[model samples]
Target: MILESFDRRTIANLEAALERVCDGRPDGADHELRSFIADAMVACAKKGQTTLGALTEAGEAALARRGISDRKQA
Candidate 1:
């Protein structure tokens, strides 16, 4: 998917948003989760969710739909 060209500030914000849920676990072991997040971001962007908050919410909702929890439970 062709994602929108966001400004540096927006890009930084989105990356930070993704990191909150991904937690720096995008190595080989967490490839699937990484892919899910990437795809979700694309989906959100396609739907005009360019803001960090919107993308984050879309990513979480997408993962939740697939029963994949990004939260860390105590």
Candidate 2:
């Protein structure tokens, strides 16, 4: 399971980043966005980005690449 693979702190950081990137989505649990967040977190963690700020930046960048603006939906 994902929980077994990563520590709680890492998971928390990723979750926070995911929330930021998913701010405008109809559903925070959207599969594609979740996948993107997971991928970005993994990539950033591998590069030693364990901090929330770094992970958030990475997540935001990933969203931007997919043309998913990180803003609240109307």
> What C-alpha lDDT values do all the predictions have?
0.67, 0.79
- CA-RMSD of model 1: 5.6
Candidate 1 global CA lDDT score:
0.67
lDDT per residue, candidate 1, 6-53, as tens digits?
666656656766776677544423768767776787667666677888
Tell me, what's the RMSD of every candidate?
A: 5.6, 5.0
Candidate of highest TM-score: 2
Whole-structure CA lDDT of model 2:
0.79
Model 1 quality (TM-score): 0.62
Off-target runs (Cα >4 Å) in candidate 2 are 26-29, 68-74
